[model samples]
Target: MSQKSFHVAVVGATGAVGQQMLNTLSEKNFPIGKLSLLASKRSAGQVITFNGESHTIQEATPEAFEGVDLALFSAGGSVSKQLAHEAVKRGAIVVDNTSAFRMDPNVPLVVPEVNEQDLLKHNGIIANPNCSTIQMVVALQPLHEKYSLKKVIVSTYQAVSGAGAKAVEELKEQSKAVLNDEPFEASIMPCASDKKHYQIAFNAVPQIDKFEENGYTFEELKMMNETKKIMHLQNLEIAATCVRLPVETGHSESLYAEFENGNPSVHEIREVLKSAPGVTLQDQPEEQIYPMPALAAGLPDVFVGRIRKDLDRDNAYHMWVVSDNLLKGAAYNSVQIAESLIKLNLL
Candidate 1:
């Protein structure tokens, strides 16, 4: 007897993360009998290759999802909001890689390493956490399990790639212009929808998404809220300050956390992280070694290091976490969810 294969669809097939998703699926050798590449009407005619086979990009409509057993969506929040249910209605289980259904009470926000069981409860759609949030939780979940996480204070140094492919190109163009002292346009950094744009070539923008009424940018709130939801810690005291850095890929975070358990030694924390699933511990300060975004790019596992105890708070500790925002942050996580679905026999 042969194993069953799925008819999988990749929504947003033309974008950066979308491209990575296709690459990852090929790299992982997922059991796919048929692959459908979907994008906006404007991107419909583009051709993409998967597993040495050519796949045509099609305009994503509710009708396009007809026999799709799984749909991986990364187009954008609006597209997900508009078409996610349509996919679900057509018998496709959706693993959404956007903010669209993340906070929905009925949807499961999943990080397989942290909450793989949540997938079983998903009501047709499963929301992938924010790129920054995904990596942070991967590194923190093991420690949280051992120590019972009480609070988290994170400051993110995100990359331009998190914005989109155009932002990465803008950073390149702006850097060249800056070096030659030529004039350049500032149009994409901070947030494309914001009133004013800032250069991201050699500067940091202290914002990721639109600001909510409470003053936290949507990105920050995603990290804060998504962590709580994924961990099932509704009262987890978490605060986030997300900043866009000039780096082209990977995201880094400076995290300070307090645990309910009494103070644990740095060695103990390192021991916990050493065996933590989906985490790579790279903390060797004597060798001046630690996780850096430049080194973390292109990797699927979350790299964590710089473990130290806070001087004032006995139960508090700080660490640094990094990962490829395009991989584990979005594409890899979405695919992992689909793999989990099959493993759990939910597909």
Candidate 2:
């Protein structure tokens, strides 16, 4: 830890990802001169314990960022859109965890392992890539660099926690009801603001966010777009189908990728991932070992396994990727960006 500390503020302090940010900051021993917890007026004045000390949650207003050095935002997109610029105006570098400013030309969409240098281009606000995008890029970065990726097709099995706390509770309640053969009405599963919600306990919901005009769900589009931005592959062919599963924490994805020049052997791919930053290689078919959501929960590293060559295409490969959605996918990545800024002297 550095001896010089800075004042830090966390927006949406009561939410799942916000709380994880506080925990990550404490666990990583990030130097903190002062900490501010900001949330909506409804959650104001709440007490939260961090590093065995009590701090009161305050309302997230333009004035709340006064004297703050870094502001990590995980609130809804609307709150981020409203307050992020205000924080920047107050001289705070913001690592926003929502999609509000992701596609902005001036904002750097960052995944520290893949694009930490992108932080150097940040005007003030840095956009954290989508949770699913984060883990995929972390795994794909090494491969992309070595093999030169030509195309990517991903199918994600996302956890309920990505939908927020209410969705997690809904899964638990629905699971209990279903086991007891009781009737359960779902009010928030695939999308709360959408027309209908589906059961997420024993079933998988194909939709992650509202559908766009192109028939892709917003979540799927986010993965596709964010991948190109983070990897600096504007012309890369990418497609995603994001589905919500009964799992509570980790997010899993099955990826099919094609390289440009030559096909890399499974051992070569394993070697690339073994040395990749923020990635753990767990491929062992004989032992029946591979990355799984249950094993990846609570970890910061993206787990990659199930490496295999495509049967028909010599330039194609397949793999499985998993990560704790609330950690590496959100909180830990934001904190890592803050660390990257410090390392690169961008802060």
Candidate 3:
């Protein structure tokens, strides 16, 4: 018997993460009976190649989801908020790669390695966690399962690509200008819509998104809140400090966690992570082997290293985690949720 296939539509097909979604789907050989590439009015009529065939992009509208069985969304929060339900109403299951629906009590925020079972409770829409949050939780889940988590504090070295393609271009332009001693105006880093933009080249910005009234930037809050939602640890003591780096891909984090139940040694924790799903253990201080954003770029697995026990607290530990921001962090994760839906017969 032939395997089942679905009509797959990729929203925001012209953007970076959206392009990554198409690449992942083709690379994974997903059973796609028909494909629809969608974007905004400005990006419509653009041609893209997929599965060795040239496809034209169309304007995304409620009516475009007429026969779509599965829709992967990565446009932006506003686009997802406007079109996700329309796609769902047209009988499509949406795996949204935006923050619009992540905190919705009805929509399940999913990281397959951590809380795939939540997919069973999804109501037409499944939200992918923030890029930084996804990598941290993938590393933390095994530890939490073994020792139970109490507190988590993460400091992120995020890639400029997290901002968008335009931000990435701005970084490159700024870097060249600085090298030539030329003056360049800042416009996209930190937050494009904000009043002030900072130079991202040869500098680190301690903000990722717009600052909230409580002083935490929106990106930091996403990491803190989304981790709790996905892990089902609503009361989990969590805090985040998000920083934008000059790198073009991959997100790196310094994680400090305190566990509740057991007193596991460093070797035991290393062994646990070594066998954990969707994780690659690279903790080898002797050879200076550790996870790095450069090494993790383009990979789907979360890379963990520099695991050690805290001197003051037996239940506390420190580690480093890294993964491609656009892959495991967004596109690959969204596709994995769709695959989980099929495997569990929930689609």
TM per candidate: 0.99, 0.99, 0.99
Query: Please, what are the lDDT tens digits per residue for candidate 3 over residues 1-347?
Result: 99999999999999999999999999899999999999999999999999999999999999999999999999999999999999999999999999999999999999999999999898899999999999999999999998999999999999988888999999999999999999999988878989898889999999888999999999999999899899999899999999999999999999999999988998999999999999999999999999999999989999999998999999999999999999999999999998999999987
Error of 2 at 188 (Å): 0.5
How does candidate 3 fare on TM-score? 0.99
Weakest lDDT window of 10 consecutive positions for candidate 2: 1-10
Cα distance off (Å), candidate 1, residue 77: 1.0
lDDT of 2 by residue, 1-347 (tens): 63778899999999999999999999999989999999999999999999999999999999999999999999999999999999999999999999999999899999988988889889999999899999999999999998899999999999999989999999999999999999999999889999998888999889998999999999999999999999999999999999999999999999999999778789989998999999999999999999999999999999999999999999999999999999999999999999998899877
Clashes of each: 0, 0, 0
Off by over 4 Å in 2: none
lDDT of all predictions: 0.94, 0.95, 0.94
lDDT, candidate 1, 13-82, per-residue tens: 9999999999999899999988999999999988887887888899999999999999999999999999
Ranking the candidates on lDDT from highest down gives: 2, 1, 3
